[model samples]
Target: MNTLTTIERRAMQAISTDSGRMLIVAADQRNGMKAAIKDAPNGSDAISREELAEAKADLVRHLANHAPAILLDPEVALPAIVDDGVLSRGTALVVGLDASGFETVDGLKHTRFVPGVTPRTARELGGDAAKMLWYTRPDRQGLDSRVAGEIRDLVAECEAEGLLLIVELLTYQLEGESDEDYAAAFPQLVADGAALAVACGAKVLKLQYPGSAEGVSAVTAAAQGVPWAVLSAGVDHETFIEQIRVAMAGGAAGAMAGRSLWKDSLSISADTREQLLTERALPRLRELAAVVDAR
Candidate 1:
């Protein structure tokens, strides 16, 4: 890992609260939102691209003011959200560079960058920083090298363009891996993944809960001074709140969350959606911010 550069430090400050914590609201989801909408009470498989854009716009319009920053995808929410004035001037933007889904090769997962989306493109989209989601399984044979190479290359690319990168690491259960066994290994996976990403020059991280307070401490230690925020992972709001509390108590930087903040607002009537975003989601964000602020 390397020390933060002046540009990187500025980008980090841009996304952080006045108190200097990352309390980011995320609406970068594409496939995840589509699935939630399809399963929602009023949703159908016939969902349109415009609907997804509007949904993302709604999230930014309603909640952007409360949070210091919002995470959006280059696919739907980028230039438009910045051009349309939906995002507050005070709110910093972090654009997602990874594609919506991954590919499976021999029971392992692989990630892809969105075509034409580089750090320069993200900057052109008015992004203060760029985030890429990378799935890692260092313990698996043949994966460690590939994963490390990709992360190191990405960090170099971002540095070349003077853009800050937030590396989001996710781990999945392998083929023939039992639920209990995977669960038992979750903490080490997250900790080792963080260490690997940082070793590859990742200066910041957005990661999943390591399943225990002790696990959270392990990740914090592995980060080697890089800031790491906790992602919601689509858990329920209450559960996510507790997780954030535990994570911050264990020295997490803060959070970059989605579903837990506004999943219920999807596929509903306009009025109902607005109400949920305002009454429920907004408060949830504030409460989460409060947790980080308290820390």
Candidate 2:
């Protein structure tokens, strides 16, 4: 495995506390957040940009105090949160480089980086690490090479800028596959994606739960000593917490989660939202933190 660069090392250190584990709160959803809010009571199907920004900032203000780091989007949340000092001292900032919109072409879905915010730009904006999400499937012809090239470019740019690169690996089914087939295929797909990300020079891996303890072990092993964390994927709080415990037991460093912790806040009034964050989200974050520390 390749050694981490000075900037990469610093980025990793920034995201991880003295415990050497990463517990991050991710609020980088742009389109997804808007969609969730549409379903919220008294919420409009047409969510304005300003509303989305406010919601994301609220998430940071309420949740950032509990985690060592947060993942944010450059286009929406970064400016307001940074200007307002929502992120607490000693909390690392990770910026998402991928743009909104997932395109389906020829039965395969693809996502790519947005224009303007490069790894170097993220570093300039005070981000310690740059993150992107990629969809991976071994059976999907030619997709891996395309995505791998993107990862390679991102890693190279981040290395030059001294920022760590965190890649979130996801898998989608081919045409005609059932949900059960997709679930069954996810474990090996995640393991393969982790190895690919590490080989492509990602410093950290943010991954979906591979569905079983054995799957978790395989992913960690394939990571080749690169730290890997589980993403919540909008599962319930209890389910995500159990996932953290099982993942940590199988050698994951910790978690980088969103939605699961705060999705319920979408429909509530501002005061009640804050109350829920304090009463519900903070306790859950603390619980996950304890799990990571115990590991």
Candidate 3:
């Protein structure tokens, strides 16, 4: 049997309940949240940084109660949420290490890390785990090697700091690829990405739903027994619930999801957003938690 380090155990326990399944709520979105808030009714085309930070904090204050772990952007929500005492005891905090933009290199998109917040820094900031989202395209030459090296370096940093490393792997279409084609190819892409993350030393995997039981099974197998969870990918609430079921049935430990749980808040007035989150979003999270426990 594989042995877990002390920090690894703590990190895993933070994300999981006594049942050992992780029902995590992710609000680490940056660009997408800005767009949603800007596009809301009577909303501005540009949302100030301060406004965005407050919005994210509000999300944490309301949603953190529903999950064992809350994934947050360190730059936007961490300090405020910590100061506000929003995170309940036993609720693990996972901080995002990647920055806001994607870098296009040779027609494929690559993620960039935020400056000065390495795994060690994240640990110093009281993060139970450090998360990074990596864009992958298995068909592209040399991209895999570059991503592997990046993961290796991050893994070493996390190990040195004794923090858990959660890698969220996503794939983008190659230039000229149609949206339909990309959607159809996503399952295989996720499978390949999961294998790569495991090989490169990811302690936990936050992955997009693979769209089918078989696809989820394949991706889980590729994880090589490492704990893996599904992301909501901004799907509708009901759809995301089904996704959690399928993923857990396929051997995923649980889910780390956002957008689907709270995106509706963006369409309403700010005054009413909290009401909607309570009425619509909170129940969805409870239902997903039930699914994870059931699995």
Candidate that scores best on lDDT: 1
Could you tell me which residue pairs clash in candidate 1? none
Error of 2 at 228 (Å): 0.7
- Residue 188's lDDT within candidate 3 is 90
lDDT of 1 by residue, 1-295 (tens): 4788899999999889778989888889887877666444555556677777887887887876678999999888778989998899899999999998899887778889999998899989998899999888867723247778888898998998889999999999998999999999999999999988888899999999998899999999999888999999999989999998999999899899899998876653556667778988999988888888788
After best superposition, candidate 3 residue 208: deviation in angstroms? Answer: 1.3
TM-score of candidate 3 to 2 decimals: 0.92
Top model by TM-score, which number?
Answer: 1
The residue ranges of model 1 lying beyond 4 angstroms of the native Cα positions read 38-42, 141-144
TM-score for each candidate, following the candidate numbering: 0.95, 0.93, 0.92
RMSD of each: 1.8, 2.0, 2.2
lDDT of 2 by residue, 1-295 (tens): 5578876777777887579888888889887777656454556556777877877777777877668898999888876788788778778899998888778777767787878888778877778788898887755633347777888887887787778888888887788989898888889888988888787777789999998899999998999988898999989989998998899999998889788877776632566657777888888888878888887
The candidate 1 region of ten consecutive residues with least summed lDDT is: 38-47
Quote the positional error of residue 239 for candidate 2 in Å: 0.6
- Candidate 2 regions with alpha-carbon error over 4 angstroms: 38-44, 141-144
lDDT of 2: 0.81
